[model samples]
Target: MSAAPEQAVAGRLSFLDRYLAVWILAAMALGLGLGRVVPGLGDALAEVTVTGVSLPIALGLLVMMYPVLAKVRYDRLDTVTRDRRLLLPSLLLNWIVGPALMFALAWLFLPDLPEYRTGLIIVGLARCIAMVIIWNDLACGDREAAAVLVALNSVFQVVAFSALGWFYLSVLPGWLGLEQSGEMGSHLLEQSRELGGVSVWEIARSVLIFLGIPLTAGYLTRRIGEKAKGRAWYESELIPRIGPFALYGLLFTIVILFALQGDAITSQPLDVARIALPLLVYFALMWAGSMALGRSVGLNYSRATTLAFTAAGNNFELAIAVAIATFGATSGQALAGVVGPLIEVPVLIGLVYVALYARRYFTTPAPLTEEDPAHA
Candidate 1:
């Protein structure tokens, strides 16, 4: 698709797409209202657990994650080598710049609330793996590169998230003078110990269920469907219909969570917003930085969109699971993670529109030619 029409047309969000923010807001209202009225319901659902993860939220995470993962073009991963121009800057942004910026924002915004700050930093460490795929597709991004980056980021998260969460919550806060000693110091150490006490294996299990399962399913579905129905029809006819389910799952998850956390949220509206501040700042900063980086490097709009969304989006499910496990269900940290998707869905959707417009600023790179002296 030509970039202009793809974006102009992409701007025309469907009924669900257009009112997604409304739906999310409605979900939040409904959940918070339910929390006040039928607090028992959220409590009952929380009790229904397996493998230390909340069953309802776990189901939601699976539904939310699978469709996005299923769309990834794993077969195209090998071709990403030709995309070094995109890859080099992309790696630097997501791994290095993105994290650094998020860390700074979390600290800058949440100096008073260490638990929420820890939660935000944990999320910062886990880059967008699944949601970016959906956002990339919406913006007509380089889906192949999105898939490869998502895969690579997921692998990296499995090993790094827990370790970094420990480090950020433990050493950095004290080192930076953000945290103080005495009883508060003891409390900080306890939070760190609780977080550190979570074995990487526990997180690995969640990764297996949430990411590993869906990734495998996505691969198998692609392989089997292509064999049975052929690639063109599968891509053309089926993928579109299958994609909306991810959004549906996302909305449902929000409803249930807000119902659970609504009381806490209602009581301290400011605190909830406090946790959101760092996140909001992080998303805006990362998206702008990534767009600037991609444009400066002469990337095409598609690849640039991929990098921007990849840098801006995050793996909230994993972040949430780790938070709930490390802290109690009702902890501020868990609340910080729950609100992630509520804020994320709207922000990313808006950025998709913004990215489409921003595409014009960058010059698309000319293909390498054997006749060019630089190539020689």
Candidate 2:
């Protein structure tokens, strides 16, 4: 299939594409309502043990992560690295620009609102993982660029997440007098602690368990299946069958997450809107900025969209896990993190369509080139 048609197919099947941002918003409302109405629900669910870890939320995340990791084609890594302009721009946007914009916005608009501010920062600091690939693919972006960006962001998040959290909560606020500028820096500080604990080991473990294991398993499974079934089986049947599981797993996780936090959502109805505004703005700004940067660097439409979507999305699963761990369930930081999916999925879907329409504007056919060396 051609890239455009394949993207359309992916979009047709993606729940993220179908609902736009509304599903995530609905999930937030559902989760908050569930959390508040049955106060013990999260507690009860939290106690359910899985391999000595009693965390239903974490388990849900683990399951959801599997399909995403499974879908990664490691062989494409080389191709990804060949495109240095795309890779560097993606990193700069995610690590430097994206986080900085989020911190500034949080400080500017939410200093008085500690939970909201912290939550916004947590969501912002997180880079894309699974969903960006889907968005890129759906937008007919350069697949290799998308893959490279995901790998790079995943590695960067490990090192930068903690420091960025600390800077936003501790240093930035004082420098900006976010204290006197808002509700008082104390609430911001208190919320910052909830958002910025350095649990590199915990995060590493989760990433390993959820992402690494599945990635290894998927690669092995693909290789084994290819050998057993031959080339035809690999191409015509296997990938298509397994590919959709990631989407299903994502939806199931979304449902449970919402169910767990439903009540809290119900009580604070407007919180979703409040949390979503900065995210919406961030997405637009990042996407536009990436496109402009890509054009300035003389990239084609596909590579530009790959960079744009990659920079625009967030890894909500990682953010949520970190938020819950640092802030506890009730903290606004956690709530803000939870609200990310609500905003991200739908907005990205719309962006996918927009990118499709915009492609013609940047349709300068470059030499069909090989993948990147770093990806190799």
Candidate 3:
């Protein structure tokens, strides 16, 4: 009855999504101004924390994450497993090719700045779980496949991110004959500076707090809403209203981050540019390559677009959280993670236009109904 989630997504870009760049910029400006003018405020906010994780950011993540996860039709994820042609290739690109590419690029580009390089490596390992859906929908991609990819990525990242990160941050650089940072030792889980030594539980606790809570909440919300209200009403009425709040939470989070760390950002303006260069290369390379991979594999435009977007985007929230946790919130490493969202919105929007233009070259797969001779 309700247009499938894919069709429903294409109606229009909501105002927040359309002009996210402006708001992000505004938030950064506000943060910078606050950091310079009212430093005390940010310092006070910084003091407010739970188990060394910043209180404001933790709340912000939950608020920003819930809506996107809620929109996902987890029940449809089984469809992805059925299409191994698309699924297997996507996994390879997302986990293997994607991480390897970014790691190589970061070292090649930023050899001198170990902290910044570490940040980029973290970004690469994080992969895309949340925002790829937005990019997929905007590109007129196969929403069902994108949703499954997101869910899979979520689970995969939680499991594999730390191990891969440890290898890259500690082991890979040594193998490559690069000098590793002393601060980034074999400490995979310990995060807090003042708490003496954070245990393994802290790592799981942070992941559970940031990801598990919102995911469970989102799934429950969707299941309950659909059961209580009919599909049409739930889709049209509920999603539209709840959707924009995520952006609001993100904007607020940016303000808090920049407000606290604006000095680091302003002192090293070139750091943003430096961090951005590899990301720019990574996003462009992945997007183009995934699209090509999809076409070579005989996927129609919708499925191809989904693969492209899911491959290209990174989970900036998780990257940011990890960066803040591993390195301090105001560290140069964390700054690069902050720079991610700032760059993602504009770049992905441009790529959306690129995808639309690219769509004409690819064929749409026939609908299931149309595929049958009887229907024809």
Candidate 4:
């Protein structure tokens, strides 16, 4: 028999759950092409004025994040205590191993390329927000576990990003090359000019304006929907309606970003290729490292995949916003951040399949319980 409407919707998303990375990649390519052909498209869209306020590409990011954040079952947080196995691996991979290795690779491969180097760090520092949950769901991961990790990671990024940026830009350059070290301060100063004299406070305001407002609106909407009807109605009716809009908004924003940067990308086609190498290496290393840690800690296959994919993916939206604020939309740092989704999507999609098939090898039989008496 055919499934119910909700079941049909769920089943449709099942394909998306498995192949989301593909969609992201397709979006990236389409955006890149549109960007090259029609410069100023992104900027024009970004300037979409409503009541004297211009909506930037960042707004699209905020909109896209709504569905994911709204679905976060915050109440379930208490029910979901941390699994040290999952937590430690994720922490080590994201903060310690992932960033360190990415910095080293970027330095080695992109010597003297300051803007690209900064972009590499941006990718490495930001943890995945959207796709990680999709990955976890696809892998049959513990939903509560994924939600808790996302919340914790989001908190950590706020604290760590600035410090990590300073370390990578200020400290690491000296170790990488004396010439690069000497130019580090100057490069940062020049990059800062790309902000067109925008203050950090102004950037923070934009973040609040974009991310905060939408998030608040989404939460309020969800709440009202829930109170008026119940969790079932909210999930069944409201989420489905809102969810697709978020994706469409995301794609539209990406198109705009590409349109704005199309000329730059066309002029420097090789730059994208150069940036992709280190990121490719970084993704693979983090993925492998997460899996190993998960095994060492004795996590189940589903939980292990969750930890692995979470560690591997980059929160490009946050990176792009920070890049634009710090280095302007035209800066190489911003371009590098833009390059992240291009490479990340396809690679992650492949990993999803690998995780699905590899589960057989990783899965362990349930431990026998004394009360069951099956062994006895």
Clashing pairs in 4: 35-258, 35-262, 42-256
- Judged by whole-model lDDT over C-alpha atoms, candidate 1 comes out at 0.73
How should the candidates be ordered by lDDT, best one leading? 1, 3, 2, 4
Instruction: Give the per-residue Cα lDDT of candidate 3 at 338.
Output: 72
Better of 3 and 4 by TM-score: 3
CA lDDT, candidate 3, residue 49: 83
Ranking by TM-score: 1, 2, 3, 4
Give the residue spans of candidate 4 off by over 4 A. Answer: 1-25, 46-56, 130-141, 175-228, 231-250, 364-376
Per-residue lDDT tens digits of candidate 1, residues 1-376?
A: 2455444543655677666658877877888889878848777767788877667776776787676666667777777757787878877887777777877888788777777877787788777766676677666677678877776777777677667767777777778876755686687668776776677787677667766777788888888888999988777777777777777877777787777666767777788788887788889988888877777777787777788899899878677777877776787777888777767877887886676566556565222221111110
In terms of lDDT, which candidate is strongest? 1
TM-scores, all models, native as reference: 0.85, 0.80, 0.77, 0.75
Give candidate 3 regions above 4 Å deviation.
1-21, 179-207, 320-331, 365-376
Candidate 4 global Cα RMSD: 7.2
lDDT per prediction? 0.73, 0.68, 0.72, 0.66
- Could you give candidate 4's per-residue lDDT for residues 122-218 as a string of tens digits? 6787777655655554444555667667656766666666677666666666565533445665767455435333344543444455445655676
lDDT tens per residue, model 3, 91-179:
99999999999899988998877677777887888787655655565456776687677667766765677678767766666787775
What shift in Å separates residue 55 of candidate 3 from its native position after superposition?
3.3
Question: Residue 101 of candidate 3: its Cα lDDT?
Answer: 96
* Error at 121, model 1, angstroms: 2.1
